[model samples]
Target: MRLRDLLIDIEPLRAGRDFRAAFIARTVSLFGLGIATVALAAQVYRLTGTTVHVAAVSMVMSVSVLVGSLVGGVLADRSDRRRVIIIARSAAALGFAALAVNAMLPEPRLWAVYLCVAWDGLASGVSVTTLMAVVPTLVRRDQLPAAGALMAITGELGSIFAPFLGGVLIAAWGAGFAFAATAVTTALTSLLLTRLRPLPPARSTDGGDGGDGEGDGHDESGSPMAALRFALRERVVGGLLLLGGVTAFFGVPVVLFPELVHTRFGGGDVMLGLLYTAPAVGSVLVSVGSGWIGRTAAPGKVLLAAVLVSGLAVAGFGLSPSVGPALAALVVVGAAGTVYGILEYALVHHSTPDRLRGRMAGVLTSQQTTGDIAGDAEVALIARWFNPGAAAVFNGLLTAVTAVVVAVAVPGLRRATLPAEDDADADDTGADGTGTGADGGPGTPSVPLGTGPAPVAAPPRAPAAG
Candidate 1:
């Protein structure tokens, strides 16, 4: 199919000035972050010459991101989302600047690197949560899946180019300049955000009967733990969080592939760059086709299939002897990863109300961070004992186990349908009871037993007019 036709069919974003501006800003920021990822890995390896140190950096960033996501979620629920994003982006810019200066110093301590990573992670978590929370407000509900696909495409595009560019920059102008470039891009992103009109903060409406409101209620006391508890109680939100954790656990080990190429395959920077590019190439293709995938299948099923496929592909990587085969395996892994990422975001967005979107985003981010930390530790330990290829096998096994558990335990999640745009307007009659829509038709089937109904079973309604 033609690209325009594909986009029209799948994309949820409206062609508006604000969306265009935000897209440009987000793209630039993602590209910069991608470059920084490669630069950071290279710098860490150069400093300590150990895979363990590289893993430690990832650990530090993950922990910081987890904490930041929690805090950011609480703030996003209360404050203006745009302002939160601006502040977070500004903080990231400053962190990049700090890293750039540290790179120039004569004897940069390892602790300095850790501190920079922490700062960057915190800013990144906050910014990401706020940005995600703002998405529903920008586009129509029917377009959310397409918008999600577009976001994935932008991220993959950034990943596809950044490693090669990072290597080139590092080789020509040192890691310092690479970080400086990140700072510049970050500043530009902040500027773009500044130009956008202010977005409304999430509103909390109290039900007349003193019952918990339609939206997730915010405890204005600024307690992160309370928000965490609320998120845990949300059946769909919690499920998505669990799914995200699984994805991170199974998928993030790919980050270790560069080190594998260096030590096991005796390839240097160029090979490392190619290894990073391999999955991204697959991701780009998958992202381009994600719109079709979303339309034809339930998101949960797509997510499960992606995870299972990724697991098998990763296992293939473990068995491959040559770099060519390994790269091909990575391509498979990347395609699955792309589909999984899109579904994860869509599920989270669908499950959350606008009021709690920020907190939900934060919760999701924290889960992802926790997963990354755990995955990194697991991979590092395995690599220290066995070969990197063996570590890949372990990661694949972990993914398979998680997928199986999710499929069995949360059968509702397997094909949980997206609510029609007006599902929220339908009368709430507790779970499992029939409710009528504004159009006097049966609405979403809410399963009280927790094993939700299929999406296709949703009541038929006239197609919404464009």
Candidate 2:
């Protein structure tokens, strides 16, 4: 293959300046969150000297994020998306600032840390969902995969480097400096958000074609519960979610890493840390070289293949007797999982209409969080019963089987294809200050800002049924 074909595609960033801004903002914000994560863990462990207290804070944050995602989804569909994101991120910035202040205190209170974590988690949940919903609007439909890949790269980079940076900062100046740094990054994200044009909710107001009140898309609006109902009712959407849930539920091998390192590999702390980081390294390599992801017509088939590969790789890891082979297996697992994730994100965005995008994204986020938490518990229990390797092998096989089952059950998803790009289009924005449609249409309908409500985009056609 050519070098260009093996590199990360930058077409989405080149498509519009707004997308560029969003991309940079997302990268910054994710890195900031990652840094905060390390600092939070260290501070909590220092204050309480118990892992249970750390877990308690994490649980609190998880619940808050869940609740915030639901509420944010509803608000995104009802209000101006840009406004909601700005407000949510600004609140998170404030929370970070508060954490900075608390860290600087002579006697840091554990309660203050918990409160700040909860606050940040809730705000992050809201901002992230709204941002996901807005991304498709900033680029052409065909650029979705590239956008997804780029976003995935940001996450991988953050996971790999932000903790190291956080540790360095803490060692040099203490946790207060790290917290202050995060606050600055959060504030920068909010500032970047302000540069984007107004993004009103795409749901129509009247009982018209895509109206939320009472029409064709009537059932689309309202709370996240309504969105959940819609997802279960929709064939392809439901199928995708089902497949994702299955993979997530069986995909956690991290819980077994400690036992495997101890008993199977006879390794210490350093080796265990290497095992934990191997997947992230693999994910980053694949994501950075995902240029072909956007050009593929058989994305659904590729996604299924990725899941199968991931399962087999995990099984291979579990079956490995030596460290070298085990690390290689984990690398393959990470690469395969990254492919699956990029395709899943693009497919979800492609399938969902603008009006319901936020709610659907929220649902996906919630499902992932819930699945990971549950999977950790389920796999840990299995390992406790049989053995770590046995649990890994069983879960890996289960995940592979789930992928095969989904392929057979969801034919529509299996045959899915992205919309074609328009060669004539230059960018998402017109010189006249109007926005263009994402579906290769001429221009989105517009209303003057401050005159009344911002104009909503016309909803696109629904996905093929499974």
lDDT of each: 0.67, 0.75
How would you encode candidate 1's per-residue C-alpha lDDT over 345-402 as one tens digit per residue? 6555544445556666676677666776677778878878997888888888778777
lDDT string for model 2 (1-466, tens) is 7889879998878768888888888888878888888888999999999999988898888878877777777777778888999899899999999999999999998999989989988997888778777877776766777777888888878888988899999899989889999999999998998988888876443443223222455455676665555455445667778878887788858989988998988769889988988988898998889988767767878988999889988888878889999999999988998888888777676545566777776776677668878898899999999999888889888888888988787666667665556531443422122444442224432211122222211111010000
Residue 387's lDDT within candidate 1 is: 79
Best by TM-score: 2
Tell how far residue 333 is off in model 2, in angstroms: 1.6
lDDT score for candidate 1 against the true structure: 0.67
